[model samples]
Target: MSNERLLIIDDDVALCNLLSDYLGHEGYRVEASHSAEAALQRLADDDVWDLLILDIQMPGASGLELLQQLRPRLRTPVIMLTGRGDEIDRILGLEMGADDYLGKPCNPRELLARVRAVLRRAGPDAVVEPRLFPEQVIERSGLRLDPGLREVSVDGEALELTSAEFNVLAYLMQNAGRVMSKEQLTELVLHRKLTAYDRALDVHVSRVRQKLAPLVGDGVELIKTIRGQGYQFVKGSA
Candidate 1:
């Protein structure tokens, strides 16, 4: 694990140092930058980073701005840090390509856990054994999915998908033409039991819908919402 490099970008020098020391102790080669400029320089150097810890509020360039620029070039899994209890910031971060978001004054252990989870999901090593969907590429209603590569395309164009978004698409593809309830999707796709009124699945579904917007208005709704039930994949097309 020590071989895996993590970059910490935050203007809070004390917090950055503390995180570097702690994450280093936990078997990660951690690097810290007090400004977005330094962070970009480190990123441009082509150093292989397994994960990124980015703070939302910074002096020169905001973390969100850096993330917007980095998304096009960086593939490192990012866990964003927002101000204390800023729910809107957290949600915005996730929508802006962050793998996860943590509030300020966070627990170190919890942050470490989130880092491990994001790495596991984003890493190629996440899928160890042969998967049923391995090497399987499915195309239905102009929705193209390649599970082996964790990619989805609409109308032959690549779609930007978060890990959860990809999981939702994969689940729908696997159960093409079958309606799946939110509970089932939350459990099966997310690998966790669903609690009452958990709307994360809905949020991810909306994101996927945005990615598949090009397929809309073509008599082929890739995902069909069943009024009382959940969603079903419209099978048999591109």
Candidate 2:
């Protein structure tokens, strides 16, 4: 993981130093910023980080805001840190394009797990054994999904998708017409078990739907919500 550079942005200087020491020991090349402004400046100057561990409640330009600002320009994976019981922040963070999130005061071991999971999902090259997909490109209606390239396009125009969104969409399209429950989707795509009151899967699915909507047309739904069950990709709906 020496080559895997990470940035930790938080207002807590002590915590930043602690994580820098710990994560550095864990084989990552880690850097820390005590403020959002400094973090943004660092990113602007050198946007080579493999991942970002961002605290949601920062001094200025909150982590959520920083994420919003960064998404348009950088595709670096982000893992948000939020206060315990701040379900709203967690949800908002994911919706704002965070790859994953962890509650503050969390166990470092768990945080490491999440960081690895997020990185793995971010790209095939990040993990030891890459998840396999069919070699042939899948197309329905006007939308096309190229598994080999991990790219999705509509009428030859590419659609921008976060890593998590791309995985969910790929899985759904791979099993088109099948109703995949939240538990199944969560485990398969997130590499984590579904927990009570967990909305991460839903948020990711919603993002995929939102991205697909613009390309497939407004009223035509390609991914359908099966209330009380899960979600399904409507084959031929494209």
Candidate 3:
């Protein structure tokens, strides 16, 4: 079975069907919604979606508007579709954290190609950009994180973390200063729901903090709790 799922939201019925057929043929499990309301409903049901194909212009809520509403709540990469070839819309879309943008009346092959590229880029298993540190390193403060090796450090040493811990840390570190809600973080990092009694994330966070206690010093707090919100990393200055 294919490892990827795609959701396409567009007002054009033919375009949606065509995309659904083409992407399904390309070995992806695909779902399509013709309106923003339907799309939101689909997303809210908390199914796993690898990517979102969103149309900028629509009847109820615009694609850009939907993206604005969803970006903080979801981490699925979006490829926005715009009817007008406006540079402004393109820039705005990218600024709002869209993975890519395309104008309509484009070739189906081209759209498919863009979708493939975006999916590959967004996939966690896909090749990531080079980082400064080794794959795994344990520093004195219990901060064990190997960006390259995708490892974790603790208390000036290394910790054996599961896949979920690593992914949660990676997601938090990527948005170090931002206070992400539990729902938002769950959606963005796990791309899935936070199940009942799933204190897995909280447990991981506690472990990470404990590991780094030694290095935290007096003023250095790696992860800070935001009241009623989520967590944020207080990055230390050199």
On lDDT, the leading prediction is: 2
User: Each candidate's TM vs. the true structure?
Assistant: 0.55, 0.54, 0.53
Which 10-residue window in model 1 sums to the lowest lDDT? 126-135
In model 2, which residue pairs have backbone atoms overlapping below 3 Å?
none
Candidate 2 on 161-235: residue-level lDDT in tens?
865677688778877898989887776565556899999889988888787787778798888999999999887
- Flag clash pairs in model 1: none
Q: At residue 177, what lDDT does model 2 achieve?
A: 93
Rank by lDDT, descending?
2, 1, 3
lDDT of 2 at 229: 95
> Model 3 over residues 1-238: C-alpha lDDT tens digits?
4658889999999988888887788788888899998998989896589899898889999887677657434667898888766777776666455888788876778888898788777767853322311233333234556554656655445666544455566666665567767766654444445777777567767876665565556666778888778888665431
Stretches > 4 Å off in candidate 2: 124-238
Task: Count clashing residue pairs in model 3.
Answer: 13
Question: Could you give candidate 1's per-residue lDDT for residues 9-75 as a string of tens digits?
Answer: 9998899888888888999988898888889898888658889999988999989878766652355
